[model samples]
Target: MLAESRFVDLLAQVLPPLEFKLYHLKTHLKKCRKLVFTSKSDKSVDAYATHFFVLSLDGIDLLGLEVYIYESREYTTMFVSKADTTGHYPSDKPPTQMGKVVQQLLRGLIRYYLPLDKPVRVCLFAKAERQYLFLGSAKNPLKHVLSDAQLVKWWASCLDGLKSEFSSIKKCALQIPGASEAAVKSYLPSNPQLPWTVGDIFWEGAPDDPTIAVKRIPRFPDDPKLRFLEFLVAEKRVKKVSRAQFWIELQSRQEFRLGTTVGIFGLEGTVDKHESLEGNHSITQKEARLLREVTLEGDYSTKSSAEYSSNEFASRVPSYAEIDVKGTLTTPVVKRTVETPQVNVLSAGLVRKKQKTQR
Candidate 1:
C-alpha cells in the first residue's frame, strides 16, 4: 500500500497546487488583450471573481482566498470568493490605507481592461443606494462617478485618464449637441449599416442588457433647429413624439398643471368666490389671516399661531364675522334696536271725567 501511494505522491509533485495553477493562468491572461467574461445567467459575472482575476493578472500579491457559500431563499447555494485580510494589505500598513491602495488597483484594472477600439460599458453596484448605475460611452459617465463624495474624486481622476486615452480613438460618438451635419455624417456609417451616432457611441445600458439606441438630431442648414430621431435602435415600438405634440399633450393633462386653480388650467378671469370640487369652500379668510400674521410677526409667531389656529379651527364652525370673497374680507354686521310707542294716560282720564260731569 505504501509503494502504491508513492506513485500518487510523484503525481502530486508533477502537478501544481490549485492556487499556483490559478497564478499561472493569470500570467497567460496578461499576454492576451481584451478578455470579456459574462455570467451563465446573463447577469454580470460575480464582481468578487472579476476583481480577483484582474488583481491576479496585474501581478498583485494575493495571500489567500476565502470562499463563502450561502443558500438563497430558493434553497439554491451560491458561492463567492474574496481576498483574505492577510493577503489584501501589507501587515505594517493600517486598514485605512487599504482604501486608497484598493482604489488605485481598481483604476489600474480599468485602464488595462478598457477596450481601445470599442466603447466599454461598466455597471457599478452602489452599495449605499442599493442600485446599479450603468455607465458607458453614450451617457455622462462623470455624473455617476460624482454621486458619492468618498469615491467621486478618485473616479473623476480615473475617468479623466480614460477620456484622454479614448480621445485618440476617432470612432467614438460625439456628445455635443450642435454638431454639424457633415461632421455627423462623416463620423457615422451609411443607413445600410447599423446607425452609429454620437449618442450611441457613449450610451451604456444596464448590466443585464448592453444594447443602446442611436440618437440622432437632424440639423439642416435651411432648418437649423434640432430634430430628434423618432425611433429607438433596439426597440422598434418606442418612438419619440414631436415637441409640439408633447407640449400639447402635457398642457391638456390636468395633473401636469401646478394646481386646478393656478396654472393654465385655472380660471381665466379674477374669481369672486371659488369652491372646490369636493364641495368644501376655500379657506381664503384663514389663508389671508395666516399670511398677514406671517408677514407682520415673522415665522415663529406664524408657526405657533398656525398650530394653535389649526387645532382650534378644526372643531369650530366658521362664523360670518369675517368673510373672504376674492381675497377681500367683508365687514362685520352691526346690531340695531326698535322703540315702543307711549300715550299720556292723564289727559285721557280728564276728558272722560268732564264728559261724566256734563252728563
Candidate 2:
C-alpha cells in the first residue's frame, strides 16, 4: 500500500543537489522492472532489492554506498554491506570522511523518514571485525583496519548529534565469541549505551529500505556456497550457516519465514525481457556479466540525428557544462519541478591543450 511513486519527491526535496542522478536512478529502476506493486501479499513484507549509489564530483569519484533495502509498510530498514566491493571511494585508503558520507546519509534518512524519537533502525551483524581497505569499505585512513568494536562505536558516534546529550542510537549488542558487557563498553567512549546488550540485534523491516518499512535480512557475503555465505574467507566457519537455510527450515515447519528471500547484487536486473521466466531463482552463481556493447544499427535516432553523442551538447550549452542545482522540490509531486543537471555524452572526444604532456 506504499505510494512509492511519490517517494522520489521525498529524496528530491531532501537532497536538492542530486536531482538529476535521482531521476536517472528512478528511470533505470523502472526500466529494469526492479520496482514491484505488492497488493496480493498476505505477509507484512514483500519485495527486497539493493542499490549502489556512487557520488562523484566533476568526473572525480567521491564515495560509494551499497545498501540493502527491505521494503515494508511501517518503515523500511537498511543494512550496510561489509564485503570487499563497497566503501572504498576516491582511493583504496579512504579517510575518516569515509564514515562521514555514511553518517550524512543516515542523518537525512532519520531526520525526514522516521517519526520523532524513533531511532533509525539498521539491519545486519555489527560483529565489528577489522577489515582492510576494500576497493569499497576496505579500510579507513585513520586505521588501516577498524576493529569490530571500533566500527560499531564509530557508527554510534554518527548518530550522536553535536547538540544532543547522548547518541540517537543507544542500544547495541555484541555477537562475539566471549562478549562481555564491560569489554564492549570499554571500547566505546562516553558510554553511549545505558546498558549495552550482547548478541545480534533484530528488527521487523525490509532488507532493502525503499522508504517503506519491511522485514530485514543479512546483506553481505551474498555469494552462495551450499549455505547463504554468511561467514567470510578469513573469518569463522559460521561453522557453515546461512540465513536462507534458516528461512527454509522455518517455512518447512508451520512457522513464518518473515520476508521472502531475494538475491542481493545485480541478480534481479540481470533478467532480460526476452528471457524465460521459468526457474529464475535457480541460477544464482553464474549470470552473464559482460553486457553486449550497444549497437546503433538501424536506429532511427542514430540515422537521423547529428547531435547523437556530440560534444556540441556540452560545449555549446552552459547548463550542460555546469551542474547547476536549481529550485527546491515541493511536496505532493512537486509544486515546481527543478531542471536536471545535464551531462554531455561525448566529452571524452574533445582534446584540450591543458592535457599533461612531455615535461
Candidate 3:
C-alpha cells in the first residue's frame, strides 16, 4: 500500500537501522538432534524433517531481518519485528497471525542463542516514535506490546512530563539563594541526548537549602604557641567566622594542656556566627553561671543610667514663661467746646461766633 510505503519512508528518516544477529539455528538444531537420538534412520529423518524445514525457512527470514539492524560509531541497535520478511505472511488471520509467528521466532532464538545460564540484554526499537523499549532479560518480558500509534502516544506523554518537571525546577531555582537564572540556563543542556538520566535533570546544590546548618571539622589546625591567644580573643569577640578561620582558631586553641588531655575551650558545638553571641566562648558550668549573673546586673545598671541621663538633659532645656508689657493700653480722649455771642439771639442774620476747647 502507498500508506505503508510512506510510513516505512518516515521510519527510515526518523529511525535508523539497528544491529542484530541470527540465533545460529543450524548449530542448535544439530545439538538438539544429538541429544534426542542415539541412532539415525529414514523414519527418524522424516519425523524430524519438519523441524529442519522450519529452520531453513527461518534462516531466510533472519536474513531479511538483518536489513533493520543499524550500526554506528557510538553503539549498535536492533529493530525487532513480529512479522515476516515480506511483511505480509504474518497476516492478522486465524492460524497465521503475527503474534504466533513472532512467538515462534522468539522461542527459537531464546532456546538457541539465549542460554538460561547467561542472560542476554535485548533492546527493541519502536520505529514510529524512534524510542527504545529495553528488556533486561528474556525471562521477564514486556507486559503490553504497543502498536506504532500507541508507542507515539506514550512517547509524547513522557516528553510532556519531562517538560513540566524542567519548568518547575527552573522556577524553584530562581527562588533559591545564590541561584541565578543565567547560571541555571547555562548549566542546563540546550539539546539533551537520548536515553536520559536523573543527573541530566538536576544539577549540584539544587536539592540543598543554603540556610541549613552544615557541620564541618577542622581540616588543618593552626600553630599552638604563636596564634592561640589571638585566636581565642577573636573567637570571643565574634560569634562565627569563615570555615577556614574556625578551623585555624580551633587547632591553635586546642593545643594547650589542662592536665593530661589537651585543654580545649570555645568552638566545640554548632557555630552560627551570624545568629549566636559574639565569640561563642565555651565555658565551664561555674563560669557560665557567673557570666549570666554579671550580664543581668549590667543590663539593669545600663537601663537605669540611660533613663537618668535622659531626665537630666530634659531639665537643662529653657522653660516657657509669660512676660509683662510696659506701654499704656488705651489712648487719651479729646473734647471740643463751641460758644455763641450774646447779640446773635435777637438778630436773625447778623452775628457769628467761633470757640475751641481741648482736654
Candidate 4:
C-alpha cells in the first residue's frame, strides 16, 4: 500500500498540464471514402469494418461520451516519497505498487468509456518499455475475460517472451510524448510480476477523498503552459477543479445558456416537503436539453423555505439549481446532503438548548 501510494504521488508529479473542451463532435460529421479489399486468408476479417453494438435502457446519448484530444508539450515531473510525512505521498514503501493499482482501476475506466459495440482505440505513447509491458498485462484480461489459471499462464508467457521482445527495445527511445520521464518511470512494476487492483490506488485512511499527495511540477523557463498533464490524463480537467482556480476562471467567461425552461415538459425540481412542490423544483440536464425556453424559477433558497414552510413537509424536494455539474453553474452551490438530510437537521429540543446557551 505504501509503495502504491508513493507511485500515485510520483504520477501526480509527471503528468503534463491537462485540459478538456466540450466539443459536440458527434453533431459534426466527417467525410470519408468507402473502400473494398480482397484477402486470401480463410479468416480475412476486416478489423476496421468489424463493430459491436451495446443496448442501454437508459436514454444516455453515447455521442456525449466523445471527448476532444489535443497534443500538448508543457509538463513537469517530481518524486513523492513516503518518508515525507508532511507531504502528499502515500505512507508506504516501494511506491511502484501504487502505479499498479491505478493502472488496474484505469482499465475499468477505459472499459467504461469505450463504446460497447465498437473496439475503442487507445493510443498509448509508451514512455517506458518495461513499465508499459508491465501495465500491458492489465489490458489483456480487460480485452477478454479468462479463467484464473489462464490469467496466470498469460502473465508468465509475457515474462518468457520478454528477452526476444527487448532485444530490439531501446531504453532511450521509449518515451511517452508530453509526459515527464519520471512519470513514465513511476508506471513500472517493482518486480517482474505485476499485481494490480482497481481500488488499490486510493490513499489509505482517506478513501474517496480526492486529496492525497500532490507535488507541483515546476515549469521550464521558456515553455508556454496551459493546463497540467496529470489533470488531462485523469479526465478531471473539469471535475476535480481546485477551489482557487475555479474562482479565478469564474471571474471570466460567465454567460451560460439555460438550454431549457425550469418546468415545462421535463423540467421540475423535487420538493423537499411536498411531492408536488418537490417535483416542481427538480429538473434534469436531460430535461433542460429538451427545453426550447428557459425561465428562471424563484431562488433555490426561497423555494427551499417555501417548500418546507408548507404543510406537506413529509416529502423532500431536490433543486436542480443546487446540483453541481461541470460547465453548468458559474458558482458552486452546496445542496442538502444526499445522504439522509434528517441527519443534519436539528431537533426542536437541540435547537432550544443551543438558543438558550446563546442567550
For all predictions, the C-alpha RMSD in Å is 37.8, 17.4, 51.5, 25.7
Ranking by lDDT: 2, 1, 3, 4
lDDT by candidate, in order shown: 0.22, 0.29, 0.21, 0.19
lDDT at 356, model 2: 18
Model 2 residue 249 CA deviation in Å: 17
| lDDT of model number 3 | 0.21
**TM-score pick, better of 2 and 4:** 2
Off by over 4 Å in 2: 1-45, 49-51, 73-75, 82-96, 112-120, 126-143, 147-149, 159-174, 191-195, 203-359
TM-score of each: 0.22, 0.39, 0.18, 0.17
Better of 1 and 4 by TM-score: 1
Candidate 4 achieves a global lDDT of 0.19
Residue 141 in candidate 3, Cα distance off native in Å? 32
* lDDT at residue 207 of model 1 (Cα atoms): 23
Tens digit per residue, CA lDDT, model 1, 244-271: 3332343333322332111100000111
**Model 1: lowest-lDDT 10 consecutive positions:** 343-352
The lowest-lDDT stretch of 10 consecutive residues in candidate 2 is 285-294
Report the C-alpha lDDT of model 4 over 1-359, residue by residue, as the tens digit: 22112112322332222211111101111111111111224232221110111100111100011111111121001101000000111112111122222232223223222223222222111111111101122222111222222322222222222222111211111111222446433333334332222111212233334432221212111111112323433765643444334323422321111221000000001111111112222233233222201111111122232233221211122222221112211233233222311111000000011111000
> Relative to the unseen true structure, what is the C-alpha lDDT of residue 43 in candidate 3, on a scale of 0 to 100?
26
